[model samples]
Target chain A: MTRGRGFFPIIRSWSIAAVAALAVLAGPAAVPALAKDYSHIVIATEGAYPPYNMHAPDGKLIGFEIDLGNNLCARMHITCTWIAQDWDSMIPALNAGKFDAIMDGMSVTPQRLKVIDFSIPYTQSPTTFLVLKSSPLAKMPDTGKRVSLDDDAAMKAAIAAITPALKGKTVGVQVATIQYNLLHTYLRNVVTIRTYKTTEEHDLDLASDRIDAAIASTSYFVSTLNKPGGNQFVEVGPLFTGGLLGKGTGVGIRKSDPELVAMFNQAIEAAKKDGTIRALSLKWFKTDISPPN
Target chain B: MNTSNPFVLLGFGPNGWGASLVAGAAMTLAVSIAAYLVGLVFGGLAAWARIAGPRPARRLVGLYTTVFRGIPELLVIYLVYFGGSEALTSLGHLFGRSGFIGLDGFLAGTLAVGLIAGAYQTEALRGGFLAIPRGEIEAARAVGMGRLLMLRRVIAPRALRFALPGMGNVWQQVLKESALISVTGLSELMRAVNVASDSTRLPFDFGIAGFALYLVLTSFSGGVFRNAERSLARHERAR
Candidate 1:
């Protein structure tokens, strides 16, 4: 009788385990599968990227890209939900179907184009260096000038001019960003490059004097410079654009989703033509970053 | 107080993050409890298998515990977040469903933390069962008590008495592990603090707030476990 009773629980336990295993396997199917026709979409962004994207104190997402994305979604006549994702894994997560689209200030570049598709450029901002106001590098050469990296002679001269002030100094850039690639391509040998997970982290390091300089998009710096104690920092050196830095920021979608690419491209064109992008840029970034025709 | 004041920054004002922080703490608690229950299910099964199963079943449980315990918690989270979705998508394809099947952040975090906690839980429960005196089990057999009756009247209660302390440790570990789930983008306590600090550029204030919230959760749970242990010990003290 005891053996029989013992056998009952063993069978019960095994059956319970089997049932649980089946439930987990079936749970994903219960999620309504996506239809090919696009009606509802999910978009991912790095909420830590302020001005472009950041969470309001109320836990609401608000920023330049958030406004632009909503505008574009409305034009396309689709409902969208925004999800906050870490920047490093944004592309991989997009492909994995964690979200259908990415609007995280991701720029369009040749290397990125190889793995994913991007909409036509939406916002264009030049990359530059930021340094402490009291630092000698604050007076870096051609401080207010724009130098297109597509121009070989100008790019070479710009690098040469800044090398003296920057050489042997520690410079910070966000990891996996076009700005990191820019530093690697132009000044890797001259400076000790440090990478951070977020642009904000580099800003903190710069404020603490842990690094001599930090580099990022000028529009991003606009937010940094407006914050408390932001006056202690100043933009320096030539504003670099084009070439390896990519055309501008765009909506990143999976290579498998050409339809999404088309939808975003059309909506972006509408926003640009009607000056919605310009209005949002001026409101959030204090400057217009709408891509030119 | 000025805007720069820590109290003002953490207060429930228009610009303050007190409400969000509390919500995040609540999310952390929800995730921990769900994961702990999942761990108990898996751990109970594995422990039973180790105690009285065939050789191959024992070996399988052994492998499950070893692999989960050996990995870094973050890597385990990444695997469950990405790999769980990948596996589910493949399974969906087998049933003729197309497109990707993604696991949301909450589910992924729960599974990852549960699996890790399950490994430790298995050891604790097995130790509990083993610590049950063989003489008592034999005495139950001598009294003609059936296996189910013996388990209810003698075995389970005693084993639980031994397991309570170890299970409490597992519970605390699960609470801490829930913070790592932020990478999956579930806005738990740690992630909430991170976002608030980064957004406001005041890490110190938000950090302290987060630190206090975690302390309250852990200490509150610790007190509950202590009470449970004392209650479970009451009958023995009456002897």
Candidate 2:
């Protein structure tokens, strides 16, 4: 029964496409009638995804993505509009033609790449865990050291060491993110996972004791730790990258927008070479976050 | 686009969003109701001040209505969420407490919704007050009723009757404004829809579901308000 209904819409859309195709063959004006492309490129962000894109107290979109988007647009000589769209609706909205690009610090993982195209990464960083300062898990091991999950002995040791502290503990992660995927893959058996829409929400829940720990971008985790409210929270665990976490955050574009995608890629490359990307990263993240060459 | 798997989109199974969407709708109603009540309390005070209070009180009420109505609801939510916690923390510190004093999302969201609600409600109630005949108050006074008795016996009832329709409008405003609470990271309807959309990778399905849920809540609430208006207007001639 459901199959019947689904087939009807597909058939209907196909008929509409056929008609659109015929119209395009008739004239140049009909060509536009065949496909609707927006003039102003609308960029959508969560406006709560800190350092990448977040809302200012005065209700304006601010942060790294805002700056990067503006610079990229300027370099590409395109007129674009920025809007604060809810993070969850961003991809759907992009497909729905509500926006043209998504720059909400969204990672370009294989799962996401299946649904959309992402430009060359703008910023690359590792994912880390945030636990309360007083939590025993905070002192587990490997402070300021990078440990790849592929290193069998080190990974096994680290996992074993953190397992006791993680037992029965709730770890908060943003829903549908790489961090959540990582936690689900590596820590799901040992810890309970609670999903939130934005990192900010998880941060609030972590502070409120709704969750014992959170997994997020190291840059974002650092920002939270610096905030006056997150006094008790400290970054912990070895930073994880490459596998599930994706390469880095990028401008998520429609699969069809290759021209725009190329433009962004060029701007990103230029920005990295000119020190603009690292400068902005240092401004927002207080560290050089340019993607490794 | 594929309706073939309705269960896959909204199912209660491993892939279904049915349970999540339902829970989201329930939360939307809950937050809207809480915000509306807060607004009603604030509106009552502001309307009273506008009608019967001294000059300073009248001016203060005017300022509140103007400020809230003039600003966007999104800005108000931001200020309440980001600034509200800091304000509470300082207030807590004044009493010698050191830890963070979080205004829970529900309370912060309620305040944001209420502030916007109160702005519209002030006008609703003021219209209600004006609609009350001066002769009715005088008649209560002439019958040897004290100020409190006059208010309780005559003023309150008539004003409420007059305010019912306007209050209905305010209720709808509050219901829609509650959508903004999603920004505060509250797991209300919008936030829940967000989570479902992200998790499922079928945003169109979840978004449509969310839109339908909001419509259900709004239309259902309208029915309740219509009943309230009907009961209040029983003695009066139908328009």
Candidate 3:
């Protein structure tokens, strides 16, 4: 979900982009010397999305990724304390040195990679639609088919297939998300796209019929889609990934820290090889979300 | 339905978020107080520069007030958090230093909000100084008081009386702006509401609680301001 700074919260589109661009250009920062030891590093997460990173009733952060993140740090011999940062500031905060890294469900989009580096994706849950089951669009064409945005003709064919169903409809998505971007790219001419700061806000609005449909990661939807009174909405539309949707969720880090990147990369590799990622994925998501090798 | 149970959801009782929310509000109070002091330092200097300095110095202070007040508050914070170090590092190398100097989130936030608040405070203080009777300053001059004595004896006390209400409004503004510091991962009132909402998935209850808490902070300060105004004005009888 897109969370950020502001009084009115005007989407943080300009200031964040401009500053992040400037930071990238400003060259090396003054940081403590890179050490061989891995005694401490602060990691951040949004704690808004579930089964990835969300807080338990006692305010303890609990989820599949939290468990795996701690396991990775242990393997790397690093002591880590997690901070729950708002999603919209995760990149800026990381770059600002508020935290050393981010473990939020941040997709590895090319646009994001321009500003921050990522570990190889730990989860690649494809994007899909959640709509009221009573809606006529429930039978939306190409349901269950995986549509990669890189496939030009096939992508167009799928877009054309669902165009009429989405026309004049109001669709909800978390602000600044790839799902929001896709709405602008493919469906802007057809529907009104409403953006929320969190997936849960949109989910609540969806249940109250404030919007006709919403699109988010299937894994995120899984966290709440079937919670009580959630039976009304059914997952619809072709699952999407690639191109604007990017590779999948990864740990966001500053580009200058190749050591941290390499460390996380090895940890993710070890987790995958040992089936730790898959087990945590299944335990939390009821599905395997570990990225394909 | 899981979010419907208000007391258990919002309470600090083991499962409730009662503790975190209180702590977050306390953080908001802490940052706002620090930022207010920063503004006091900047505003005092800027107001003095504007009122007594040479023409060029006055123009520079004028420009400072205009630019900071003109841009939106959020942009100022972004510049502080993201752009501050980047600019500092480059500015560093220009003077022959290498490496990075990172600003902590709380520092960045306090400076940004305080910097903006200082712009308004400068104008308020300047107005307060102008309101002082010019004859009083001449009398101070005739009595052979030096600049510092005049400032401490005649100017400071009077201007402070006039400036309290305006500074009170500025205080409220700073308190509200403290919520924006949440972007830098400084846990405060707004961030607390967000975390609580996401945690409980019940935005309304948390939203109401947040609104009430802000009201308490604002109205509590308003009461203090009113009392301050009365106490400061006590010397002036009803003529």
Candidate 4:
């Protein structure tokens, strides 16, 4: 009889603990932390990459990716939460289960796809170089034209044009990025290569005279040049696309999260149809970088 | 939301990070041990320089300890991460080598944490050294004991006994400080939890789990060090 009486309280406490655990497992969607679910899911962004993502001086994340992510989330009935993660461990952190998905203008490259999955392309842009305006590469012909990597003649011409100026000079690129891979493959022996963890870091190093040139996305260069400190650098060399640059940037998700992928796909489609992607692209990049059809 | 799936994220399954977390904990221990040893060596040199060397040498050692101990730990980790590789490459360049000099994350993290730990350890060891009775050393000398013999028999044993508690504190400090190495991209326990949280989008879940793991590490180590102190003090009478 005493044992039976004691058992009730134990069972009651156990059930209470179990309920609390279940509530957390249900995620913010079941019981929205701040507002009604409205089928709205919160998306996370780094807010460090310019044009793709960046921070306003007032400490707000404002960039092309943030705009695109918000629009996509609105279409999918989800909210957005932009946060920063150190770029090197972003994949490891993604696999560890931090946020629902990453929409930091991460390119949909085959190499990156090995560890995680990506949504369909959202924005497409080619890689380019930004160097000191007085640098010889700035004198190269057709400075503003886009050139594909597959065009042998154009590729040779581009290589020939930049090689002499780049010879014995130091070039900076973000580590593990397509731009770094491109530099290493095409010009490793000819020039000194320095890889930084982020575009901003390389940008800082460039300003400090640590590197003669920096290679990144054209949109990124445009945004950087708009900033106060970036007035010294000018775009140089052919805009590199296809092969190694992979396709356009896309949303990244863990392989196990198929449901989340479906939800994001729906939202991305609605965003593209409504011209939200294009609008954000123009706002941040000053040009249309919406996924090329 | 099912309690039945409590083990889903923690279990050693393909989806779970249990294995990674365990490996990360092991890495943390490894880095801490390396850092503690490095601190021991650095502290010994520092104490020697301070107590036995010229006035200028002592001042320089004092400055090292002061600067390291005064600065915040996070800032120290950042300075080391960003600046360590550059410093190493410059050294390599002096040897006429070209190209980037790779300082693996683990080694760099260990060195940074160790260098910081050494500053605190130096003062502890010095206090221990100073506490040695002057009479005991004089007696050892009267008995025709050489400087080496006096240090081995009288100075070291007594100094170490007094220093045991202090050394234990330094060890604990080193263990805790290892967490800062995560920013260098070392996949230690904290970093593993970060990765898991980012991937799962369950910040609260992973953060709480990481907090629990750290508590366990500290508590377990606290017990071991307490036992060691007790054993070391067994021969001495209460003051």
Candidate 5:
């Protein structure tokens, strides 16, 4: 006989109540707001993803996003405080008022837009593959080519070319990231996919031979490759952006803070216009990832 | 490549993360102490309820312990750390207050580990209470000792002595359980190792270092508890 009143109903009701309550609470908080005077702002970053953001041994936050955020914050005339949040919790933490905005190399995508708003992209670098120099994947087709995922023919060609080499291989990407989605869409069936909390984890795993290849932004891999013992790793596969990779990396702000978003957008635009972004990208990543016109 | 040497990675030099690792160890101690205090409050109440309260109150205590003990510690930490604040904020909304209410990592981790420790501590303290000699209470009552006098003079002393060994075990459990709090992003020993391993790309070095650090912490605490047990039991007759 079924348990009296049933456990399923209790769990269902509990979850339904939770969801409804959250919806009610989240509703008013997310209603887009009018412009407000900028005074101070708090920005969060995942201080674990190198080149984008990571912590120095001295416990200081340093990386491309930190530099870029500071520049933009300066231009916007806002005093900013930075906090390091884990990658998975960054969005929820932002929405929860743990911080005013997120500059953790977050990508701008329609899916994300459903929850939060974004400043116009500052870095539109394509996603690419990084594998050991000796791995079969390192020699996969079109190593130096750039393929836009938005292009139907190029997408078809790139997928067709890389599928065979990836068969039965293990690939790793950070969990809940744009790279995960890209891997899911293109390589899930062909490869055994592993997800990690941060790029550092997958990178470490890749180094320890726990994973066959890793997927992330070329900008990250570029900075990574510059590190000592990095010569052992090589970029693999055609770089991808647009479709699943997102519009590009942008500052994630609360959906309620359209004015904050507007301010960041303006600052980012000026930086792009004046080559600050390009210069920083070069210093940190040794490449210009500033959005191409 | 420069960090390939373990000493270089662990040294206090500019390139080394010695400072962070030590700071992380210190944070682990702080969080553990905070969590232990929380466990003490919850455990004391649960034990009292189980020993003296009505049937329904006892059952509620049972349910609390059962549910917390049944789930994995990692799951408990995640559920509380990630979901608790959201739930609190939602509940707050019903009262017409709005905005996200956040539980910072340290507070969230402490509450979580404390809860799990409370479940264990309840059993330990209850066992200690059960072992208290009924004759002593009777003798105290016969001597016209009031309830408070009996508790202060007889029950508490015997129960605390018996509870020492059990509470020692619970303390150790809480110390180890603090490692699970790392997932919530509290800068504890385990998370420090994770960061260093990732940054240095030498997983084993950091892994072994973390293991050693934890061993040092637990063993040092183990000695303290052992000495405490001896001191607390000094008046008890040798069996």
Candidate 6:
């Protein structure tokens, strides 16, 4: 054992060096040739978001956006592969060319447009507050009513109506999201706002009464309510859309990929016309969220 | 069996995540092994430089170890994952390539963890070298052994024996640090478990599964290092 030990170290070190060198050479070596080839593309998604994009128990990605993405890709004549990505870094990764586009329920906001581009809106869902059924806040004002932030008077009135009930209450929303923006901009003075990393975390907090209420898209809440302990939660308050919420969920693409964005827009238009979007939305969300023509 | 049962859910059924979880564990091991090997190369070279190289070489290694060890592992990972691609893309532009050239997730993660692990490994290897008795080196020289011959016959063996335990500790560190690679979206064990839990809405079940798998890996690797240490020390015991 002792006789061979010294040689082993020398050989091991050499092999280690060799492996490191090979890894360095192989790691970023696959430079996607700068061609206008639209034959094959990779799409990224935050697979944790249900009814939009989510992983199945079998490790396959499936959901509303998955269906729509495949449909759009089919129409665009591109073979698209979907990869799960963390929500926070989705845009950066797209711009970095980690993937060609993002279809992870990403809303097209004016703030986001400054960085990346989006395809035409594929699905539009309203934002609302979720509360425990037993909580007094469950009976929030203007329940089931839609409030477009574009109508400043209606938006302010909706905020005013809910402020009195939410005063001194702690509300939860996912961080760095349109819902968080809405809360920070409008309800910052009224309620103590808490931010969470994911919608599921806030839903858990609401179920445990750590938060008086949680806010997220109505489509997301549909998945929440379908969960085992979700029966205890109820959606209240006016539905919010437009303005700060952006122009609904769309495929997030890099600004350099104008042709890809155009392709997606064309496919989406076809999908809407053919009722493919409506069918997928009904299958996943049980509602037609296809943007009105 | 009920699909809601934890065993069934983690089983190999059509709806179960057992296969994916196992695949993720394999990925975790692959990444850790690759990164550990990278650390070994960096650590060995740095140790050699710090001990015998010129003053400028030692200072450069010093700065590298300090900066890598000083930053948070997550930040290091982010820098490698995003920054690596950014650098590559710019480099491509320099070569008249217009589009992005991404650093593979597995590669970025391994380099990040390996670079961090290298800092700790450098100290361990350096200590191993320092702990070598001066007389042993002198004895090798008196025997008319050349530099490379002495290094292979005496220095390498003695230093490695001294460094075995520290190297073992660094292996453990590298294994745990591999979990952070999940952020790069390389489907490692943690990411698999997260996807499973989130998808099924059964965090408790999947969380326990992840906990068990990680425990098994750590304990099994711990045993391997212990055995390696024991084998390496056999001559001392015989004497």
- State which candidate has the highest lDDT: 1
Deviation of model 2 at B47, angstroms: 36
Off by more than 4 A, model 1: A1-32
Candidate 4 regions exceeding 4 Å error are A1-44, A57-59, B1-239
As for candidate 2, its clashing pairs are B11-B16
Q: Per-candidate TM vs. native? A: 0.93, 0.55, 0.87, 0.54, 0.90, 0.93
Which window of ten consecutive residues has the lowest lDDT sum in model 3 chain A?
A6-15
Per-residue lDDT over B28-134 for candidate 2, one digit per residue giving the tens place of the 0 to 100 score: 77778777887887898899899889999999999999999999998998777657656654654575543333333565677788888988898999998899999
Cα lDDT of model 1 by residue, B28-88, tens digit: 9988987898899899999999998999989999999999999999999999989987887
Cα lDDT tens digits for candidate 2, A91-131: 65465333468998888989999988999998988888898
Candidate 4's displacement at residue B123, Å, is 13
Q: Estimate, for each residue in A206-272, the C-alpha lDDT of model 5 and write its tens digit.
A: 8878999999988888767977778999998888888878888999988877888889989999999
Give stretches of model 6 more than 4 Å off.
Answer: A1-22, A25-29, B1-3
> The CA-based lDDT of model 2 is what?
0.73
> Which candidate, 2 or 6, has the higher DockQ?
6
The candidate with the higher TM-score, 3 or 6, is 6
Clashes of each: 0, 1, 3, 21, 0, 0
Q: Is candidate 4 or candidate 6 better by lDDT?
A: 6
Model 2 lDDT, residue A62, Cα = 82
TM-score for chain A, candidates 1 onward in order: 0.90, 0.84, 0.87, 0.82, 0.86, 0.89
DockQ, per model, reads 0.35, 0.02, 0.37, 0.03, 0.19, 0.42
Q: B48-83 in candidate 5: lDDT tens per residue?
A: 999999999999999999999999998988787768
Instruction: List residue ranges in candidate 2 displaced over 4 A.
Output: A1-39, A150-154, B1-239
> What is the CA-based DockQ of model 2?
0.02
Local accuracy of candidate 4 as per-residue lDDT tens digits, A148-241: 7777788778777778878898999988788888898889988899988668767766766778889998877877787655668888777788
